[model samples]
Target: MSKTILEDAIQEELSFFLQAIHECVHTDFNCNRVLNNAVANIISSVVSGKRFEYTDPLFVKFMKCLDENIRNIGTANVLNVLPIVRYLPGDLFKFKQTLRNISMIDKEIIRPFIEDNRNNYDDSNVTNFTSAYIKAIQQRRQEGQNTNMSDGNLETCLRDLFIAGSETTATVLRWGLVYFLNYPDVQEKCFQEILENVGQSRRPSMKDKTSLPYVEATVTEILRCADIIPSSLPHSVPHDVEFRGYTFPEGITVLPMLSSALHDPDLWGDPRNFRPDRFLDTEGKFQKMNEHIPFSLGHRACLGEALARMELFLFTTSMIQEFEFRPVDGVSPSLQGLPGIVYRPQQFNMKAIPRAK
Candidate 1:
């Protein structure tokens, strides 16, 4: 089911990219907006069984809200440690405002879909996550089992899946473009690999990944350098646990410093450099490392990791195969982007020159 959804999304994403480039009169474009909408549409289809056009007003507003809320939420905030801080003015930390914005999204954006799913609930036909959840709630009631799949809970879950699943992938792609623009040689290598593996007559797929080792390594390097989610979400230690001679008591909040491993000098030599060769073995094949935990580790790792991987590979290869990305007007974009919930590249324009077939 997930594979089908991703395959459909990759096709749509490639079409959207082509359309965006064609519409650019001067060949100048904002890759960030195009990438964000492309990714968000995937989640929109999965969660609500509907995909919105890029220019849809309500959909644009919802995207804006998600972007703002994500930016407002950094690695860690004082509100998490002190509940009293939220009682202060909304302008102080933007905490209350962020919550209010998200609540509006839940009420205005998610509630309507939940209502529709509930009204049209069916036992056998489960088209999307919303429908499957509604069906589960009904089935649980029929069996008289204790289930918490209430409308509100369902709405929150859907919202989480939509935002988390969309924004992270979009940010990573945006950064990927930035890196490629900064390093044209790397971009050309990726394009060459894609061309040799998957010809211009067809779109690239997961099967092409093995044949395009450099492309795979390039994607790995982009994720390592971008560090979208530098700090994983807060995880609680259930009971007193001791690891490496350190005792962590029960109920302690643990923040997995992923950057520590991703940028470790011993693990990754010259970890600060944007080099895809680090992920490639001497034989020119992609090398998988235990330290390469971009989606993170453990059972509670990213639920959408598989989908994200497919999106990254397919969308990136499609773009490289179709266009040669370059900085607009010979202006280079800064690598150090504004850090929010995710590390985002700076707002910079770029040109996607069509490649000769």
Candidate 2:
């Protein structure tokens, strides 16, 4: 994406969040849907060249599809490991239905957007990613080269972009707010850092990331405590290897068990505790740790890591700068989130009192 498009998306997201916070002040509200809408629009613009209204039915369906897909992916089913198991009676592998829904939504909805972009393909005036993609495909065709670039592949790519880009960051931000409500002192410290560094007059940007160490640390802690993908995506042993008296054979699927490292008592003195200071040195500067592998590690790591980090910083900082989050009715949410392929906090509501400008 271009710099201008990124700036516009950031500004638009900030605007939506500010309005949502204003509406939730002194009242109980679930910020998840609103936050999802804002983040969804950013990815939507990149994939489809336009944003959707929060009230749009199609957008809601898209969100539902994304949610179901994530939930199903997190689930373990015999059918997942063996396709033959799917022939068994009953909804033993209901997750397959969820996967099918996702494919249907992508084929029915996202494909049309790609088609429209291809219809309006213009090399000089490439407005969005879809158009740019079409140009690339056309260019490859001109060379008579074998390419995997097709409408089906394009639709799948678009679906992957939205699924990877939208939900994960939004979930982190949602968990960020939950952490803020759980630890007010930490939240206040983050707010103060934002105020001191970026001020309340302007929205927080990626440029201000370095100036707000406490905010950065707090976001890091949120990623740590949340451990969104506790088990992480599965990996395979390339060849026979030995480690710690264990030998794995080639082509053997392995679970890296990231939760072990993330919450290891040795690395983090109090692994269960929410302490942003764990990521900060005595000098109050942000400290880096190899143990902080929220997005996994190595070559197959998330392609969207840069975008996710940028979104997390800007969104978390802007929220702390603009509002004071508190649990509704003096009730705190459970830290033990719903277990799945990706862990997420239990459904909860909060009050977002606007900070004094």
lDDT: which candidate is best?
1
- lDDT tens digits, residue span 138-224, model 1: 789999999877987887798889779988999899889899988999999988888777889998888788999999999999999
Question: Model 1 — which ten-residue stretch has the worst lDDT?
Answer: 71-80
Off by over 4 Å in 1: 85-90, 120-124
TM-score, per-candidate, Cα-based = 0.92, 0.92
- Candidate 1 structure, TM-score to reference: 0.92
User: Residue pairs in steric clash, candidate 1?
Assistant: none
The weakest ten consecutive residues by lDDT in model 2 span 71-80
lDDT of all predictions, in order shown? 0.84, 0.82
Q: Where does candidate 2 stray beyond 4 Å? A: 2-4, 74-76, 82-85, 88-92
